[model samples]
Target: MNRFDRFLAIDWSGAMGERQRGIQIAYLDIEAGTGPVLMRLPDAKNWGRVVIKNLLMKLARADRRTLVGLDFCFSVPWPEEGPLPEGEAPLDRVEELWDLVENICSGEAHYYAGPAIRSMESAFAPYILCDRYRGDEFRFDRFRETESQLSPKPASIYHCMGAKQIGPGSFAGMRMFHALRAVNDHRIAIWPFDPIEDANVVLCEMYPSLFYQMAGLKRAYDHETIQNTLAYFHSGSPPRMSIQDEADAVISVAALRALAADPTLFSDPRRVAAAQREGWIFGLAPS
Candidate 1:
């Protein structure tokens, strides 16, 4: 297995407007002794998707072996009922899904305000409902198999509304994935879809909540909690953090550090089958 030299954790957002405050980027160098540091956009309050895409392209050009963790559902649950429309092929592969989402949801964010997803005359239409989001009614990917067992179960990627909802973020994330793939010409290796191989940049789906649980910490944007979590990951003593800081990013980078130390995390036997189609979270145990 190729060891990553750098780990990046991105806390994503799908809200309207030119910029989103919910977006946060954090990274750590395996050779660095200190904890992860937050990245700031120049003269901007928040990061736009384009800016992030450019940054990643630069990283790839630099020949850096980086593992990027974006906090969003990489793909939705495959339709369980029947075959899709004749031309609308099943999303059995991640690249195929990315192309589909980019083609359908181009030029707008939040999937062009849900109507685009609702109007999608394809097999995935049922799962992206703006209202009435239920995961049990629909089966998610293999990575989400343990979702119900965990506290604060994750909302379905189709659920686009409400504070705890994840649908909007996922829709926006798919758009980003599409853009990144175009810029890189499909050179980026998205885990499960393509083997790790000798790819310079590897992208994976991430759930910050799982990292918090692993670190034995509660969900709060406080200095002490961030410090404690960093301490748990051997990031040395945590640096001072503000309540306004994006604490999830810090915790996520620390979690990536832990994951990088263990090769078994990436070599799970179950990943061979389910991950190729359904997608999987980076550090989640097999269900």
Candidate 2:
């Protein structure tokens, strides 16, 4: 039976691998195999290509049924194709990169290429629900439920791809990226970020007490966001002294989700961690 053997959770950004601290931080998750990689790219130009290239290559090499999830807008309405009026020709790189991702994740290419991670906006029709952060839970009956704040005008076909009114760093923005990818790719599965409603039960499987303690630290062993703490643990490194300790914990949460999905396919925690020292450790197998 064909089943998933490995997976990758990516928090991608245009500025990935170009942070002042170091660009390699994104791969920290993939390399460490501890949590969700913080993919802070430098900009939009080659970002899409760079991400896809690495992802595709990794999936190819693993020779396993791998699922890669990313929180980013992957689709946009095809604008009127015409000649640029002035000096905007060089920017064609953006569209080109977008096409690459769309093609790889959609139609016939996706079935053979690999699995995709998309957001709620896409047409994948995956069910999702959200806790609404209000403490009062709400279920999303539709494939996608947009925020009530959008205004008098209804959402357009392109609404999913536009910059969310809330701006970056907010979960709202993440949804736009996911929706775009969903519409573009047939194989990708789109979902929401709500804890209670989403089918991605992995987010809820972490050791909470340990997870929170690690997540709420002053300094991180590695320079990761507060949401990435747990992912670092898979690297065999204990929490470091940094303000971003919570980041490590968050990362760890992602790793555990991957681990819980199919524990038998993973290695002993001790052995898997040891392999991390040699190079990137995506996952382990049962001993």
Candidate 3:
């Protein structure tokens, strides 16, 4: 197997921000024989798809493996088209999605969601814990949470949680849970989610001084600060590791994993068809 040269991470969100209210895209480039580099596009609603496609194009153009990862629900409840008949109300398609979730949690599939992480009081609660299975074995644990209510979701490529509640308990809570599960199970591999190495893969190339400036700053290393930094960039705000920087780190890790798995998924016609059959969302395409 060849080492992926191009890796892209995404910190996705549905809400709009102060400057731009749309998806956030962060890119990291790891050359076969070189170090890591970072690239980014300001905010836009469809930024997610755009960045991925552009990155792939660059990789393809250079004949490099284009790896990409995102922290979003590629599989969602099918949208309800129109209103129902007289007395009938709308139904939640979550149950259908849940069937998929069950398979993931049971380890029948490759990935699933993480349990919600709230306060310590909430984290230890039973209902909050999710079911996990490895082969015939199973374990349960509470969800993980971030400071901000709005943040990117975590992913699980290997092990995932079977949720008792619908819609990823919370954005950060369940997604981070799933990502951790994937890492622990070896379904996915990633650099440590710390600042020094993984967080600034291209720090030496871009914003070198910022990296050193943030060193030893407690807020610089805070979980909330990370997510906030991602949001800032998405909103077209100036760089501030206090919030958005950390979020990008999380997104970068996830993106690296996605790209490593199938850099050609977006380009290979056969892989696209197979992915479609597997129920992956394919709306993201380069313009």
The TM-score values for the models, in the order shown, are 0.83, 0.30, 0.31
- Residue 172 accuracy (lDDT) in model 2: 23
Better of 1 and 3 by TM-score: 1
Poorest lDDT segment (10 consecutive residues) of candidate 3: 200-209
For all candidates in order, the CA lDDT equals 0.68, 0.31, 0.31
RMSD of 3: 16.4
lDDT (tens digit, per residue) of candidate 1 on 4-102: 889888888777655777888888887776778888876957886667777777777766688899988777654353223334555556667777767
* Per-residue alpha-carbon lDDT of candidate 2 for residues 1-287, written as tens digits (9 for 90 to 100): 31344444443333213121211222223333453444444663323434453444444444344444433332222223311222233223323433443443444221221211233332221211221121111123111112121222222222222332111111222232333444443233222112112121111111122333444543334544343454434443333333232343335435544444554433233243222211111232323
- Clash count, one per candidate: 0, 48, 20
Which TM-score value belongs to model 1? 0.83
- Report how far residue 192 has shifted in candidate 2, in Å: 9.3
Top-TM-score candidate index: 1
Residue 95, candidate 1: C-alpha displacement in angstroms: 2.3
TM-score of 2: 0.30
Q: On a 0 to 100 scale, what is the lDDT of residue 134 in model 1?
A: 34
Candidate 1 overall lDDT versus native? 0.68
User: lDDT score, residue 208, model 1?
Assistant: 86
lDDT, candidate 2, equals 0.31
Candidate 2 least-lDDT 10 residues: 141-150
Cα RMSDs, all models:
3.7, 16.0, 16.4
Best by lDDT: 1
